[model samples]
Target: MNFQQRKNKILAQLASRGEVDTRELAMALDTSEITIRRDLNRLSDEGQLYRTHGGAIPVDQPPLPFEFTQKATANQSAKDNICRQAAALINDGDIIFMDCGSTVFRLCQFIKNRKIKVITNSMPVIQALQNTAVSLNIIGGEYDAARQAIHGSMAIEHIARYQAHKAFIGADGLSAKGLFAHSEKEADMALALAHHSHITYLLCDAAKINKPSYLHFAPLETVQTIITDAALGQLSYCKKKGVKVITV
Candidate 1:
């Protein structure tokens, strides 16, 4: 089949199954895996889909709120560094709450070797840690295709049933007004994560510091710690308010 036909088939599979694996697509299209990869790369570059470890998922419709894959690439180095520090805080057998933020998602790779229980609402997180040593408990709720996460009142209710030693979450922005997000649903999830955990850690990059989004979910004092890049280490206001600021 031609590139156009293959692309259509790939997208059709993603729409039907919510994801498309390279090998499966190759087999279905009677093409080489290399060729399928090239097509998936082109489609990813064109924003037609978001590439995962070995597959592609549909991009968010309208694309106003960034897709999970898109956000994952933004300030990637900073996110990885911050996540490294966040991972250090985790101990063996500890139960943690992980939110569906791009930065928090990076934590999956770092903590895979550790023996810990992760309670999360992110499908991507579940996929990343499925084969790892870390135990996972997925928060059941409505799946949001755009965010590649779970949400809704049911998700919040599910989170309330468990308590964690630490909560790792993200925000669209942080300011004197507190943690904010572009979507109210995300803000609510962050709040629920913080509420059910003994200690909450806000994971964000420098760009989000002091920036405020439309919806404010939690106050600055809600989280006990904030992990970010070195550029945003001088958060005197946060320190004065008893919030530990750790920069990497």
Candidate 2:
């Protein structure tokens, strides 16, 4: 097929699957991987798609899906590394407050075997640790089915009733001013968790840095540390605010 034909096929695949990878495109189009990569670069240059490590997603990508699992896949590698660093900071027998953020949800896998106790409103976290060695305190409130978590005034109040050694939370966006959330309920839960914890650790991928959302939850300086896949040149500024930034 001609390059134009291949381009049409690639665009169609992206429209259907939300992303397209060089290897898969090459296989489907019966072309070399290098050729597919070149085509993707051309499309990126034309603002037709946004280039990622090994793939391209729609340039004008719609807002992320509301489901927890879908959101988890956006920056899976970065989230995994960030969670690894966050989990490493936990010591045996420590109490941690974990939020319902997709990034925080990944922390469940790394901490399942730890002797630490977890306080959370995330349904996924409870399901993950229910049979593990970790103790769990589930905050109860209104259920958010889309996110598979609990949120509302009750959930916020429940979190305030307990104190933890550390709080692991996620934010939709982050700026020098503060952490941002898409909704007030989420912001309230994060704020409550941070308030009741001795130390707060923010878990986020590099993309979240300087990204703004609707509701501003906690200030950037409020957190003791931030764990991400890349520092993205924000290390010095975070350090100046007394927030230690850890890059994986």
Candidate 3:
């Protein structure tokens, strides 16, 4: 089979299964693993698929918003590792802003014992840190049932009332253009948090890098640092943009 034919087969598999492994595709197509990787890279650059560590997943034109439970399970290990790294950056008596991103929610588990203040709109983060020594400041606004979080003009106003030492956020997609999200409300909240904090850290898994989403919140330069899994391959691009890329 030719290059185009192999790519078409890979796309077909991605469409049916939602994801495809490099080695598995190589075996099935009777091609070398290197060739499969090249095809995946090409397809990913074309925005047809999203390349992962050893595989690729179909790209959603306008990324879908995942529920709290669904996001908690997807890439759980990667999220845990990233959160651990982020948790270490916190100091005692520091005030922090936590966004309602699922990956940011994982940081709550690792930092529940810390003696720091947490201002957030995430119900999950509030629940996770309620019994801990961490001080909780919940942002009040209209509740979003689908996201299980609070967001609106009031939430933005509430966030602006306080400043933080650091703000940790998550995005549906990250590219050279900036951070992207499926919901405009979430984007507005993230922007507010970024503006109110001294430093901003973007917490996301490798799969989200270079993936495009519906709403562009802010540019890569807006955040001080980006914490992600080691599978991300855009370090050069990030470095060129003057954004610190921390791979856990």
> What local lDDT score does residue 240 receive in model 2, on the 0 to 100 scale?
67
**Please, what are the lDDT tens digits per residue for candidate 1 over residues 108-136?**
76787789999999887887677668899
Per-prediction TM-score: 0.74, 0.72, 0.72
Residues 56-127 of candidate 2: C-alpha lDDT, one tens digit per residue = 767764333346556766787788788888888999999999998989977876776789989999876776
Q: lDDT by residue for model 3 over 44-72, one digit each (tens)? A: 88899877666765675222234565676
Q: Give the deviation of candidate 2 from the true structure as CA RMSD.
A: 10.1
How many residue pairs of model 1 clash at the backbone? 0
Off by over 4 Å in 3: 1-66
Worst 10 residues of 2 by lDDT: 60-69
- What Cα-based lDDT does every candidate model obtain? 0.84, 0.83, 0.85
Where model 1 places Cα greater than 4 Å from the true spot, the runs are 1-66, 230-234
**TM-score ranking of the models:** 1, 3, 2
TM-score: the better of candidates 1 and 2: 1
